[model samples]
Target chain A: MTMTATTDRTLPDPADRRAAAHAFIAGQARWRWPEAVFWLVAAASLVIFPHSLVLAAQVLIAGLFALSLDLILGLGGIVSLGHAAFFGLGAYTAGLLAAHGWNEPLTGLVAAGLVAGLVGFATSFIVVRLKGIALLMVTMGVALLLHEVAQKAHAITGGDDGLQGISMAPILGLFSFDLYGRTAFIYTLAVVFACFLVARRLYNSPFGLALKGMRENGRRVPAIGGSIRRHSALIYTIAAVMAGIAGGLLAQTTEFVSVEVLGFQRSAEVLIMLVLGGAGLLYGGFVGAAVFLVARQILSGIDQTYWFFWLGLMLVLVVLFARNGLLGGAKALLARWRRA
Target chain B: MLLSLANILFNGVAYGMLLFLIAVGLSVTMGLMGFANLAHGAFAMLGGYVTATLMAKAGWPFFATLPAAFVLVALASLVLERALYRRLYRAGELDQVLLTIGVVFMAVAGATFVWGPSQAPIRVPAYLTGTVAIGPFDWGVYRLFLIAMGALVTLALIVGLERTRFGAMIRAAVDNPRMATGLGINVDRVFSITFMLGSGLAGLGGALGVNLIGLDPSFPIKYLVYFLIVVAVGGLGSIKGSLIAAIVLGVCDVAGKYYLPDTGAFIIYVIMVSLLLWRPLGLFGRR
Candidate 1:
């Protein structure tokens, strides 16, 4: 045992291991064929599904929101039930800006992201310190607080009446939000694509790898010179920004913002979307959002009244048997097939 | 001024008692069992509906339905714990949360369909109608009755959990299930019983709260934050902590509503977040 241990001490030199890690990171950072196909299909849907642009735009928004949630949940191992706090903030930010004459779509998104990130940073002190259910409650509390505030602030939010009569200028002073839903779909798709690109790049970076280590064993990460608070705060803020932009997209695309944008149901819906897609994987949010929205559309079309029951049943079925969600199930099947 | 203040205090304490009644079970389920049962408020909603149905449709007195609600909801919870919740005890935290959330959704949908999404009204019995003299001032008999019931329940829980052999088994099981199992304790049975008790109390609390808080389809979602606040602030598994936290939050809620209606509801959420920040494990949590 002693001789074997001594031999291991000098094996697989540190430099070689470092080089291997870089190669692995580079390989992961490179876009895979599946991602290329996914985006291509998404962009192509603009023409393929000409009549479904509105729903398509909505899917993109939910996808972006779910993607933001995925960052903290799948990557940082932070679980929350109130991620709508940032989304709501973003929506309101863009809505209020449009209401107050700053209707430039892209800039509105930036402002939404900044506001959401600031709120996230402010809350990070509390968020970073918690784990499991406690974290869920705190995050929920923040969202509920925001929801309550939104409901009560009648002058600013228009209370239950919602923020109405707000309009945004055309994208880049050229493409106006048309009645045919083309501009909104393209705008949302472009924004979602941009955010996804940044998120995808970050997912395989050295910092992202360190985050995975933190998620696996937080105590060990601290021992290895990682500041858990700093990493969590940064990722949490980035996710919040992404969520905010999604919210901003909704406000800009729809030309309205309602108090329900900040509701607990919205938060829960996005969580379901993320879970349905599968967490951690970058494409999981997009896939989950697509399935959830399309399923919701079909269900609501059939029975508008009892749709919540169907949703509940779906979530229950998902949690019970498909804990890792559809993508995970497919991957598991793939692994078994390979083994066979 | 003194009398109104006294009235607010009385109402606030009564509210706090009701909150404690609902949240104490969650304190155990989440704090002791380490399961995030977000649907806890659903059990409370079920209790409220049972009471409403018994009093309104079945011509039962308001007081008579409380026990029925407790018994019925306890039975329902037993079925749920056995078939659904039991499967996820050893599962991931998120799965447990999602499952319970799913349960909440189903319960909400069921209630909405059965009860038509309207508030279920329970008649305030003649016995609890008017104010009675206490010291120099008259206080509402209903509020006084709520306080008395809350105190009785608290005492019973403390004695039952601390003085009984079953309670010892529960503590052992919660602290270390492996060791408790090794020592011949039936951990599963203990957990089921504990869950039943927790859910039963929730039902009773819900039944009792109908007059003050009202019973509705949205009850579970609406008061979820408050129940969670009580459990989190009080510290998981600490009955004493929950009672204190409930009373503190109840008073704050009541006072805030009365004093500053515009921002009163926001205060509790802020307080919960701030307290959790200071005591992440909770004010009295051991873990």
Candidate 2:
């Protein structure tokens, strides 16, 4: 009996080892100093710029969109060019809901998430099977189709006049959406923060590690007893939900939804934002959205027609020189500083 | 009803030929060279603009401007390949996409700056203006010209690729670049020439298609999807596949527009998605 017990102790169960590793990784990811500092700085920005609440709200929505993209592209290694499908779906759902008198914010957001998640779930089966350029084409096709549908469905979508007269109610029977966007900013921030926490939890989970493994080497996933299709579909659905929430937030704050919400340009712009911030890192979305949105606002003010020229040039330079994006560049610099 | 069907078939074939002309070069670059060039539509736009400018401003005949468009676009592509695209041969698909997208934006913006934000109108020669009566069907003379041009180019391409020494060299280089290099074939030069050839064809297509598709600052963005669809559905690197796919797409698009006027451009995408789902590697694409 003692010999058998010794042998069992010698060869620990694989499941136990996995659990221990997961716990260790989860511990490591819990409330890092950098994350704390990042959130602190973000909070401080709201305090410092009291008047720029609308812009702040817009940035938060953009950041949320970027984050949703990051979950699929960065972590799951699914490069989608049509993520605006979910965002638009969410926006339209919330916009329609408000326009038709279901003006509650939280319920509308949840409905948006569910609608987008349903769409994502339905599409993921077909989409997850594709890789590389084929995947890109399919995603693009979906977005283009949605855009055309939205454009042509004039009776319901308002046909380029945009879905208007969407009046959202106060947050939790208080904090009405003021013209100054004070309530909008705080509500957006809170939603983003809540979504960020969920994403963070997912990132440190066993499923996230599995996704990481697949990203590194897709072939090895099955050998280790993981289903790429199942995992991809799950992540895609979750990402869609997150994107839906972002879109709903935008609609609620702005009280409008345009066909532009479903445009290919929006998809491309979100991709550019994610790439600019640095993919693979959780905070990269926030950083990228802030920089891209702010830069666009400034550049458009300077020369509305010629702003894309500068934006295009920046994208080219970034892809050529800074493949890892702004955050990656910063990380590299910090590492160098520490080494020195 | 029969006459409308005939007209649709004829128009579809003409449009398909135009798409083939634009997409063939893109397929060669994407499939043969392994480069994801989203700026290819820009080259086609350049060709159209060149043709339009010469015809409208210089009083050049429409037919005479086609070759000029081809040559100019070819030369431009050659210069760009040497200066920029050559360096990105080994870059990831994401980088390639971003770089090409940037080029597209720049091209669009530059075109807008140079030629004001208006569609460039084309004046077809008088002989090519009217329709021809054939067994109770009216076929546009300009469309006949396009069909003829497409056939000639397809014939030349097939003969050149299959029955010539230069064609063998290209095939060899594409199949095994390392082996071709070992055999002392200047693979780089072969690629450059091929790239130029592809760009030239796109230019020719653009020059020919300007009247049919319209030309404007947003030309690249507008037609990029169509070209990409042709290349993708044709099963990249296959000329015959592109030809077949383009024809099918053209027919479907015309039919969809005629039947379902409400959906506008949605049907083609639906077709693309369904087809892609059925065959992920494209209809004729290799595993």
Alpha-carbon local distance difference test for all models: 0.90, 0.90
Q: Considering only N, C-alpha and C atoms within 3 Å, which residue pairs clash in candidate 2? A: none
lDDT of 1 by residue, A164-267 (tens): 77898988999999997999999999999999989988899999999999999989998989998999999999999999999999999999998899999999
Residue-wise C-alpha lDDT for candidate 2, range B81-176, written one tens digit per residue: 987788898987777888888888888888888887899989989999799898777789999999999999999999999999989989988899
Standalone chain B TM-score for every prediction = 0.97, 0.98
Off by over 4 Å in 1: A1-15
True-vs-predicted CA distance for residue A9, candidate 2, Å? 11
- Once fitted onto the true fold, the runs of candidate 2 whose alpha carbons sit more than 4 angstroms away are A1-20
Global CA lDDT of candidate 2, please?
0.90
Among all windows of 10 consecutive residues in model 1 chain A, the one with the lowest summed lDDT is A303-312
Per-residue lDDT tens digits for candidate 1, residues B1-287, read 89878878988999999999999999987876788899999999999999988877889987788899999999999999988988888887888888888888889889998998888877877889799897988998988999999999999988988999988898899899999999999888888888998999999999999899998888998999889889888889999999999998888989898989989589888888888888887888878
Candidate 2: tens digits of C-alpha lDDT, residues A23-106: 899785779688889877777667888887788789889999999999999999888889999999999999999999999999
lDDT of 2 at A49: 86
RMSD of 2: 2.3
Evaluate candidate 2 and give its CAPRI docking class based on DockQ.
Answer: medium
